[model samples]
Target: MGVVTSIIHKKINEEENTILFFGRILEYKGIDYLIKAEPLISEKIPNIKIIIAGSGDFSKYESMINHKNHFEIINEYIPDEKVSELFQKSSVVVLPYIEASQTGIIPIAYAFKKPVVATDVGSLSEVIVDGVTGFIVPPRDSKLLADSLLNILLNKNLKNSMGSAAYEFMKENMSWKGIAQKTIGEYQKLLGNFEKPRYLIGSLQ
Candidate 1:
């Protein structure tokens, strides 16, 4: 993994300020708004690298980019073997989705101990504890998205704090043991009597 990671580092030109826009580049993923936020993000970070890694038709989005030099686009299906290397290389993960049902990206980012900056849509926000795990901005609002990215990129301490929290959140909340405990707690709290929830599981309404 280290050898491959080194190769990826070269591909990224060793840019640590890189924000990754990963996953399938579909319309609902809102790559357009990311292009719109390019200038705003560059005004502050300057040498920022926005790495778009995933399989999709990118010609349409290629023309929309302003600072063409600042982007590192890999418009192809990233293999599972390389996925860890890619995430480990990123400073932050971004999901500028305009529409979503749910996403598994948040947990994946957290697992890598990387902070995420995603837009509020569907169940995305429900996962991110804004300003704690990561920042959640309004969907389709490029400025807010850019601002959140800037916030994470500019402050190293804040970024580290958020990343650590993100990992912990996933470790504790998304795990089977944690989920079971939380679920039982919720049931107990709802009943206010520590009663068994056997009857509540559609056995008796």
Candidate 2:
């Protein structure tokens, strides 16, 4: 997953207490957990604003979003070009996934140099370096998730530092060029001992 490298690192409408969930709305995506965690988060961080930006049937999650004043849902498809805008404006990106392989959102948030709060499921724990780049809480635990978000949102210095670290991690490890090179290296190692098929070469010639 590659980010728009052209989008320079500069603060764009950065709100210190804004948390975002940017992706498709689905049950497994754990938007419900995030919504459930909101009351707990708001109890601690009163000024917190949660922006749920994605396209889906948000009506299913209506009951969980008890704190409507603190939660704003843009229940429509976010255009590819406009994705960066949401990433840039928020203080932190949240992926409270109950089950996940990986998500493009994590790297995109890293590209924007925003800290993340994600659930400890699938590759999320591996991607987010807890207390370094972002926080990873136990899956389906709204309380723990809220605690993690509150921790980051409450501390400005920690939030900024984590965001910076996230950007560095993305540049060093998650860039598409690096991933491609690694894939190529693995292929080369695997194929180095194989003899070229003479018939295929002759056909090409």
Candidate 3:
């Protein structure tokens, strides 16, 4: 599902240490936290490239970006074609949302075999197994967010391990078949009927 490396990310120049914070830009998405974490991350890995892509007015965030030279901001709609390339070039995907109902970004990152660093918001915690698929930090905590991102960026084995786990998690849990199976299991447990229903059977579809 990966596209050949493209100019969008090659322009970052340092793909290995790159962290992606992509998706629609909005106040509740906590771009500020990622910005605050930059200096903290730079203190350890100096040449890190942080790519912030998606549509919205980014001018409001100008004041927060202290490491301006290290950041590549795409403050307009990104085409569907280029998304996979962006994910492929990134070492980790970060979700620093202060508030969120849910997000589809984590699965996309996993599909690229990329690990995620997300804040505890909405259903993100349910999908991202902390320290396994990715690390889950507290919302709006820049230091912890920085720490989690640094963990994946600095450790190659851990990053790959987590990314692989994330991909498997997505594959096994996100599939309709898996969902239906789990649903059937839950019904059996709820009704205390572990035995297969022979007399009265029903189809899930």
Best by lDDT: 2
Q: Please count the clashing residue pairs in each candidate, in the order shown.
A: 0, 0, 0
TM-score for all models, in order of appearance: 0.83, 0.84, 0.84
Which pairs clash in model 1?
none
Tens-place lDDT per residue, model 2, 108-149, is 899888999998888888889999999989999999989989
Taken over the whole model, the C-alpha lDDT of each candidate is: 0.85, 0.86, 0.85
Question: Candidate 1: misplaced stretches above 4 Å?
Answer: 1-15, 186-205
Off by over 4 Å in 2: 1-3, 6-11, 184-205
Q: Which is the better candidate, 2 or 3, if ranked by lDDT?
A: 2
Model 2 score (lDDT): 0.86
Output the TM-score of candidate 3.
Answer: 0.84
Residue-level lDDT tens digits of model 3 in 1-205? 2222232342332278999999988999999989999999999998999999999878899998887988999888888666867887889999999998888788788777789999898989999999999999999899999999998888999999998998888777865666788999899888885565665556532
